[model samples]
Target: MTLTKDYKVLSCDLDDTLLREDMTISKYDSRILRELQKLGVNVVLSSGRRAYDIENRFKQIGLEKDGAFIIGSCGCEIVKVDKMEPICTKVLSNDTINVVVDYAQKNNLNLGRNLFHYSIFISQFKEFYYSTTHLVYTCQNPYNLEHLRITNIQPLKVDYEAIRKMCLESPPTKLFITEDPIAVSSKILPEISKVLPLSSRALITKAYFCEVIPTDGGKGPALQWLCRNYIHCEMDEVVSIGDSANDVDMLEMSGLSFAPSNSFDVAKKAAKEVLNWSNMESAVGRMVNRVFFNGTFLMTDEEKADSKIE
Candidate 1:
């Protein structure tokens, strides 16, 4: 019943695992995590999201002082939630950034930004993914400029100077290129990978998003680093939860792993068990209940079908 039997540290994805589609944490899930933290468990947020966003999320749930750590930028950086400062970081070299920019410009492909705290994405076309009203995803808008801090990349000519300056001044912690998911996966990624310096790496985080970071940066390795350097625990004391292709490595590295019923195939395959509820239904609370209390982790087929029921 006690987590002392296994995990001492927990790493969870931010978007789909902990936060709801509205980017808010449920009261039930928050209560479970806060209670677990009070019981001496180290809960960490692992995400491709920027450090700024993670800090704000912790602030939103009043966990900024609850003893938390963030493996941000898909493991390119780590920050302490209490301090709001990066403990360690890995960034793509300036030379590498220039190379990528040059390639994108020559090909007329739009690339995202990787600033110190957040990533920037501006729609270069009318139908870009982040612009999807159904998705409601954006780092910056005029109403919340201070928090979003994203560099607009629209109206190509106007943004050119600003974009160039940002690249020269900001070393990318992790950069992304957004387009038609189909084009990104099929033609763009393969062609770019062939030219990137061997020191850099790129992968698909979403259908319309391809993330570029240092070759050594990965969420699993970052989790390992956190265990060794920050938490002082063995890999066996760690638990990971995630829900996408990007979360595959972190899921694989954990002593215990779980994915929502609605998670992608790869993430589910990486988990030792699947939760009875999906994220919208607060699957995270159920996961914590199973881990820290005498709670069930299994689901019947009917219950599974009902996970999607409104």
Candidate 2:
């Protein structure tokens, strides 16, 4: 099959979809990504991660200097990967954040503050560290509120009522709430959906956390935006591959979607095709070879067998 030149962009989610379990990109995955880009496919990283966090990852992969676009903070911020320039940004007002923080303190609930292009702020440093270890490595920056730079703190207040109001009113691109995020997300996602908006989707990357991103923010809108605004391609020409609930939107939105064997049922249902192998087995590289390069590539027989097995 000849791949179309019309699709020039491949927008992808970061955590469970693109990055491996160790939070590192595999050699196979990176080679495939670079090859795809050389074939004229623009790879854009889209995630609920903060822009700085995602930027650091891309830098690790040597893609930070390659002119990719990153949609971070659940679409609240969009930036150019090469220059690290902010293309657009949306922040909750300071007064709004303060109100939410005050409420959380009064209720004895933990709250995390996401600073713009800086570190996150929290009321209890221990709670924050325990909750966000997978996403953020621990920092020595003193938890003392007095010592930390006030300018870097942009507090994101955590309150269900306030969050619900925000959802009803302005509606942030994403919102999430979990009592024990690590325990609830991976095992029981449908149950979590009970409290969340039906229109929105949920993804659990870390054991204790679940993300509530825009129904469109999934790989779909990110790809759509890249196609229309950046690469000027059509939706039907693009192809996406992923696994898990977070990959659902992108799977549905892409011209063609592929899922690994270990993917969640919801993601499998949405995928156009399911790869026989899982991410641990290099499914990403196999799919890229099949779709983009017409199958003339290096791959293990197990991988090839898996691709054709089902």
- Candidate 1: tens digits of C-alpha lDDT, residues 164-186: 56656867676666667788789
lDDT of 1 at 124: 60
Q: What is the TM-score of each candidate against the true structure?
A: 0.78, 0.65
Question: Which window of 10 residues has the lowest lDDT sum in candidate 2?
Answer: 128-137
What residue runs in model 1 are displaced by over 4 Å at the alpha carbon? 1-4, 64-67, 114-165, 296-310
Model 2 C-alpha RMSD vs. true structure (Å) is: 9.8
lDDT (0 to 1) per candidate: 0.70, 0.57
Clash count per candidate: 0, 4
Distance from true location, Cα of 203 in model 1, Å: 1.5
Candidates' RMSD to native: 9.0, 9.8
